[model samples]
Target: MAIDLLKRVDEIQAIGAVPKILETVAAMTGLGFVCIAHVTDDAWVTCAVLDRLAFGLKPGDELDVTTTLCEEVRDTARSVIIDHVAESTQYAGHHTPRIYGFQSYFSIPVFRADGRYFGTLCGLDPKPIKLSDPVTVSTLHLFAELISKQLDAENRQQAARSDLSSERETAELREQFIAVLGHDLRTPLGSIALGADLLALKVADPALLPVVERIRRSARRMASLVDDVMDFTRGRMGSGIRLNLRRHDSVHLTLEQVIDEMRGLHPERVIAASIPDLLCLDCDPERLAQLLSNLLANALVHGNAGTPVHIDARQQDGKFVLSVSNEGQDLAPEIIGQLFKPYWRAASRSGSEGLGLGLYIVDQIARAHGGKIDVTSSAGRTAFTFTLDNVRPVST
Candidate 1:
C-alpha cells in the first residue's frame, strides 16, 4: 500500500501542475480544513494546506509530532478515529479541537511508498461528523501523496539551478585566470630572452650582471604570482589554505621587503617607511609579503613617481595597523568604492595593462586571516589601511 502511495506521488510530481492539483484536491476532499504537514523529530509542521475557510492555521504551524493523533496513526501503522473530542480519552483536553472551534477531526498518516512516516493529511469541522467514509479518507491520503511529489519536484529543480550557477562561475574564473596568466608570463619570458641575447653578444660589462639578476627576480615574482593565484582559487572554492602563523616583526620586515622591490621599479620615487622594528604579528609570512607587494605596486603604477609614498605599521590596542599612502590625485568616489572588486580598474586609466585582480586577491587574503582592508582618498592623498589581530611588540 505504501509503495502504491509513493508511486502515485511520483505521478503527481511528473504532472508538474502544483496549483491545478491543489485546487482539484481541495474540491474532491470537500473538507472545511485540509492540511499537509511534514513530520520532524519534534513537530509536524504544515507545508501546504487548502483552508478556504481560513481558521487562522498557517502553512508553517507546528504540532507535537510525538504525541499528536496524526503521529499515533503513523506509529501504529493504522488509521484512528476521534468521533467527538469531548468523548475521547486521547483528545478530551487537546487544544486543537477547542482552538479551531472543531468538534470532529479526521487525520490520516502520510507515508513514503516504503511506509516511512512523513506527516499527515488532516480535516477538521465545527460540528460532530464522521469522516471515516472510505472514499473521503482515501482521497485525502492521495492528496497527501501528491504534496510529497510536489516537494520532491521542487528539490530537483533547485538542485539543477545550483549546478548551473556553479558551472557559470567556474567558466568565468577560468577566463580571468587565462588573462592574468598571459599578461604575467609575457614580461618575465621577455626579460629572460633579452638577458640571454645580451649574454650571447659577449657584452661582458660588469654592469650587465645586474640585468641578469633583474631577469631572475622578475622570473621568481612571476612564479610567486602563479602560486598565489592557484591558492586563491582553491580557497574561494571552499578549500582551506595552510597558514603558517608565527610571531615576527611584521611592520619593519614586511615594509622593508616591499620598499626594496618597489625601489627597483621606481627609483625616482621617495618611498618612506615609519614602522617600528619590534612590532610583531601572527601571520603567514608569504601571504603578507604578497599583500604588501601588491599595495606598493599599485601606488607606484597610479601615483606620481616623483612624490612620496608613505608606509607605516604600528601596534596599537592589540592590533597591528598597517597603512600605505601615496601623494596622488584623489581617487574618484565611485572608483574608491569598487577598488577591491575583482577585474575592476579605474575608468580613467582604461589603457593601463592590468587585469585588475590584484586588489581583489589582496582583499580575499586579508579576510582569510580574519582582517579587513579599508581605503580613504581625498584632495592630494590616498591611503589604504588594514588591521590584524594578535599584534604585539618584539623584545630586543
Candidate 2:
C-alpha cells in the first residue's frame, strides 16, 4: 500500500521549526514531554517531540486518535489546559490523563497559514506545574504561529523551483530544433554548389563565366555560414565539439590545404605560409582545417590590405604550435576578453561578416585536443596562436 501522504506532508512542513519549537516548549513550560502532533479522526501522529522522560516518540510514530488529548483539541478547534489534572474538575476523571500518568497537561490547537486547523502543540509532566499562568500559555501560542509562517515560506520556495525546472526543459527542446534544422539544410546547400560547378563547364561563353564564378563563390560562403551555425548549436545545445584524433604522418598537409583554399577565395590579398614539418600530429584533421580556415578569414578581412598574412606551424620542444599573424591596429582590451564568446562580433564589421562563432569554435577544437589558444595584438602586429600536446591517443 502507498504511504499516508497527509502524514508525510505534515512531516515535511515541520522539518526546520519543529525541533526548536519542541525545545522551547519544554524549556519554558518545565514539561517532561513536549511534542508537535498531527491529529485527525483516525490517527494521532507525532511530527516532532522533545522526549525528556524517555517517551520513545519520534516523527511519524502514531497513537490511536481516540486515546490522545490532542484528538479533543482537533475536534473542538480549541486549546486544552489542565494545571493539575488530578485536581481539575474537567480532567480529574479524564481517562487520557490517567492512561498517560500525567498530572499537568497543556495543549494548544495549531492552525496552518491558510487558517485551517492542522493539529496541536502539546506538553505534559507527571508533577503538577504552573500551567495556569498567563505567561506560559502565551509562549505556546507564539511558537505555533512561528511554525505556520515557516511552512508557508517553504511552500512558496517549492513552487518557484518547479517553475524553473519546466523552463529548463523548454530551453532544451528549442536547442534540439535548431540542431535538426541546421543538419537538414546541408543536403540542398551541397546540391547548389555541385550545380554551379557543372554549369561552369557547359557554359563556355566568356561573358557567362563571371556569373558562374559568382554562383560558386556564393555557394561556398553559404556553406561556411552553415558550418558556423552548426558549431554554435553544438556548443550551446550539446556538450562540446567532439574529436576523432589519429596519428598523422604529417600535420602540414592540412594546414597547407587551408592556406591554399584561403588564397583561392581571396587571391588579391597577399599570403605567406611556413609549415616546416617537425612532428607528427595526433589530432582531428577536419577540425584543424576548420580552425585554420577561421583564423585565415579573420586575418584577411581585419589585417592591413597591403600586408601579407603570415601562417606558421612548427614543433617547439615537445609541443606543436600553429600561429597566424597579420598587420592591424591593436584591438581594445575589452574586445580581446570577449573574443571567444559566441555571436560577439566587432561593431565596425557588417552583418555579412557572418555570425561571430569562428574564434569560439577554434577555442573548443583546441581544448578537445587538450590544448589552448592565445592571442596578442600590438604595434600593428597581431597574432593568434594554438598550442597542442602532440601526444598519441590511447585506445579505449
The CA lDDT at 192 in model 2 is 65
TM match of model 2 to true structure: 0.57
True-vs-predicted CA distance for residue 380, candidate 1, Å: 1.7
Q: Candidate 2's residue-wise lDDT over 204-310, tens digit each? A: 79998997887687667666766776777778776789788787765788888889988987899989999985347778899989999998888888889999999
Task: Give lDDT tens digits, candidate 1, residues 63-134.
Answer: 656555676666675765566778779788986666567767777666654556766667666665555655
For model 1, name the residue pairs that clash.
none
RMSD of each: 26.7, 28.4
lDDT for model 1 comes to: 0.63
- Candidate 1 error regions (>4 Å): 1-221, 240-242, 392-396
TM-score of each: 0.49, 0.57
RMSD of 2: 28.4
Error of 1 at 394 (Å): 4.5
